[model samples]
Target: MRAVSLVPSLTEAIARSAPGAVAGATDWCTHPPDLDVVRVGGTKNPDTGRILSLAPDLVIANEEENRAPDLEALREAGAEVLVTEVRDVPQAFRELDRVLDACGVPSHPRWLDEAEDVWSSLPPPATRRTAVVPVWRRPWMVLGRDTFAGDVLARLGVGHVYATHPDRYPRIPLEELRAAAPDVVVLPDEPYRFTADDGPEAFRGLPCALVSGRHLTWYGPSLAEAPRVLGRALRAARP
Candidate 1:
């Protein structure tokens, strides 16, 4: 089946679940880099004409990925669109099932079961201090309470002092970094890449670790591998 994936998170799942079946994907679909697949552009402004020309049997889009115009165009072209939206872990599983169903692949309930089991089995993170940079510079955003990243940190035995905040991403006064007094500041490398060379001068006097943002945020079958990688990094960087 010729399918086009426009979401980055689902791109990974589609690549793992369907392998070489993805005929067209977005530029951000680097989880399984499409060295040969057609590019429909990107999540926000996917080339509707290019995707339409491919004449795909199925098109996988996400509420968060495709803009209304492109989505409308796909529908106008009479493409069978399977839209997926994920917020929490359970919703992620439900969306995965839908994608699998779209691809005509057998639903792998065991994988979801295993992921939930692994997630539940994780010892809640300790009260050790930690700070996650959700966005870089400009407004200076941070992960607040109830976000997927916050949940991951909570499970890793790390404390998120900002867990009381309402928004998933909250704009913070840059000076608050000093006030938080976190033992370790984690600068993630995606959505806004924060690197070691970049230095934690802004967080001067605070311990810091640049982390893989994908592992901290993206949850899916990849979590099976990510938890271990993130856990090790967190442990090694422990103060």
Candidate 2:
């Protein structure tokens, strides 16, 4: 079955589970290092013409990562679109299973099993701390309300300071975020590519944990290592 995957995590899952099933993917679908599918476009702005030209049997997308108009256009053009909504770890596993089954993968992949095992193996948190997680700078967008990253951090005893905010991603001023006085400030390396030299300076007084964006945000093979990777980073964070 020929499939076009707009989400990078789903692309990797498909490629790893069913080697040659994917026909096209977005330019951002960078996993599987050797993936050679047709480049349709970006997640927010996929090239509809290129996607239709590929004539894929199915297309995979995420509710948050993809635009509704693009998905509608693909469906209007007679493409079978499968949209996934994963807000937490359990949801991610279930949705991955459903997507893989729809793609004709006979059994659960090793990575999925490993991811479940990794998360399950984690002991209860020894300490709990409120953290401010910044996904972007400049305009200063932060993780708020229900988010996959917030859930992941919560599992590791790190709760988001803005998790109760009305918006899923809220744009707040830097001064306001600092004034929130979180126990720690977590920064991921994507969307804004926050680095030690770049991001840590802003929160000089707070303990900063620089984490991998792929492990923190993506919901594919990275889930298997996220618990350990993020756990270590959070543990090592110092004021």
Candidate 3:
């Protein structure tokens, strides 16, 4: 079964589980490091013409990472598109299984099972700190309401202020976020590349935990190491 994955996480899972199954992948699908699929383009702006030329039987995408117009265009050209929505850990697990099955894999990849085991085995934290997790800056966008990253942090006993907000990823003014006065500002490496020197300097006094975007955001093999890796980062920045 030939597949084109627009989501990086799915691309990794598919490539890892059944090698050579992916005919094309977005430029951002960088997992497996040695993935040799045809580079279609970015997740948000994939080259639909390039994807179509690959003649994939199945095209996998995420509701959040991929745009609707591109999916529609693929559909209009008679390509079968499987769109997955993963708002939380449980949903992610289910979606991953569904995606693999659609790709003709007989069962869940070993890494997928390992990912679930690790999350279920996570110990409770000593304190559940309320944080403001920012995904982007320069007109800052934050994880607000029903985000997978928020749920991942929630599993780690980290509470975020925007979990109750109406919008999923609301763009709040810098002043408003400062007014929120969260215990720490959690920054992920992707979506913005929040490094120790770059992101922390912005919030003069507040503590910032520079977390891995792949572990925090992507829902695939990285799920296995997220608890340990993210826990360490959060612990190092503990107030």
Candidate with top lDDT is 2
Q: Please give, for residues 55-75, the per-residue lDDT of candidate 1 as tens digits.
A: 888888877547877888899
Give all TM-scores, in the order shown: 0.84, 0.98, 0.97
Estimate the lDDT of model 1. Answer: 0.73
- The list of candidate 3 runs beyond 4 A from truth reads none
Instruction: Give residue 148's error in model 1 in angstroms.
Output: 2.2
Q: Using TM-score as the measure, which candidate wins?
A: 2
- Show where candidate 2 strays beyond 4 Å: none
139-184 in candidate 2: lDDT tens per residue? 9999999999999999999999999999999999999999999999
Better of 1 and 2 by TM-score: 2
Tell me which residue pairs clash in candidate 3.
none
Arrange candidates by TM-score, highest first: which order?
Answer: 2, 3, 1
Local distance difference test scores for all models: 0.73, 0.94, 0.91
Residue-level lDDT tens digits of model 3 in 102-201: 8889977789889999988878877888899988898799999999999999999999999999999999998888888888889999989988777787
Q: Tell me how far the alpha carbon of residue 9 in candidate 1 is from the true structure, in angstroms, after superposition.
A: 2.7
